[model samples]
Target: MNLTLKIWRQENARAKGRFETYKVENISPDCSFLEMLDILNEQLVDKLSHPVCFDNDCREGICGMCGLYINGRPHGPDDGVTTCQLHMRRFKDGDTIVIEPWRARPFPIIRDLVVDRTAFDKIIQEGGYVSVTTGGVPDGNAIPIPKKNADEAMDAAACIGCGACVAACKNASAMLFVSAKVSQLALLPQGKPEAARRVQAMVAKMDELGFGNCTNTYACEAECPKQIKRSNIARMNREFMCAKVCSEE
Candidate 1:
């Protein structure tokens, strides 16, 4: 199939960016979205032109590094899949695809389709871990955690930090992402000790990094590749309130 791509091009964080169009032909329907871009880059290189720059580490979708706003949706039209998992077959022949990087102040473009997502790393650094000494891995039955809490914790832990949640939010909020991180730990016994501190620190860092507040638009939950729930946000708000109350007391 032949396709037209209108992709954003930026030289650096401070450089002005714009959409540049290119055409690719005879792409396989089975080709992954990133593979299609690879074909386009190879063609440009043969002509002595610069290739499009995009971030991709694990093409298997586990890494969440390959993020692109395709046709105004994060990770294309697919549900519960990352850009690396998106396929060319999802588009029709001769279709024009618009691709851009995550558009948020916290995720400034480094070039073309790559943005500096270290803001996420910074938020994680703020407290997103079970720093307590839980000793070595215990026997599965030793913990005896309620199955419901364990299930919810595992679900919250599915967040891959792709910034899609931030990109999909009308306010560019990181609430969904932040909440998932908070809930994953707060529900687990290993993480319970620091739940209050972890929630406060991460939320404070999220605000300091210029991420917007959640307005309940639910776009983040809808676009999240892992289907991370907005219920995580509700849990996080409760955690935050409890922390505030405990601190005051």
Candidate 2:
């Protein structure tokens, strides 16, 4: 198929950026969005021009590195899928596809379609882990967990930190992302010991990093590639309140 692409182009973090148009032809419908971009880059290289810079790894969608705003939607117009998983078939021939990076203050632009998502790494570093030692793998039945809690924990654990939640919010809130991380640990017995401290530290770090507050718009939930529920935000709020109350005593 033939398509027109209006992609953001920036030399570096401090450089001014703009949309540069290009045309791609004869692209396979099965070609992934990143693959289409690769084709465009190759065409530019043959002309001795610089290629667009976009982050991508494990194009299989496990890694959230390929964050892009396509036609005003994070990861394009798809539901529960990342950019790398998006296909050229989603667009029609002669369609004009607008591609940009995640637009959020916390995620500073590094170059064309590339943003510094190290803010997420910093938030994770604040306390998104379980420090307790299990002392080798325990038998499945050893630490019996309620199936409900286990399922919910696994659901929350599906978050890939793609920054789509932040980009989807008018306020650029990271609540959905932060809440998923908090709930993933808070729901599990293995994470119980550090639950309070983990929630407190992570929330504090989120605020420190300039992420906005959640106002229940649910845009994050709708745009999340993993469909990470806004319920995780509710769970996080409960954890935060409880942690604060206990700490006050």
Each prediction's TM-score versus the true structure: 0.97, 0.97
Q: Please, what are the lDDT tens digits per residue for candidate 1 over residues 49-162?
A: 999999999899888798999998999999999999999999999999999999999999999999999999999999999775767788878877899999999999989999
Candidate 2's TM-score reads 0.97
Task: Quote model 1's TM-score.
Answer: 0.97
What's the lDDT for candidate 1? 0.94
**Alpha-carbon shift of residue 165 in model 1 (angstroms):** 0.4
Q: Which residue pairs in candidate 1 have backbone atoms (N, alpha carbon, C) closer than 3 angstroms, thus clashing?
A: none
Clash totals in order: 0, 0
Tens digit per residue, CA lDDT, model 2, 94-171: 899999899988999988889999999999998899886668888877888999999999999999999999999988
Q: Where does model 1 exceed 4 Å of error?
A: none
- Model 2, which residues run further than 4 Å from truth? none
Q: lDDT: which candidate is best?
A: 1
Clashing pairs in 2: none
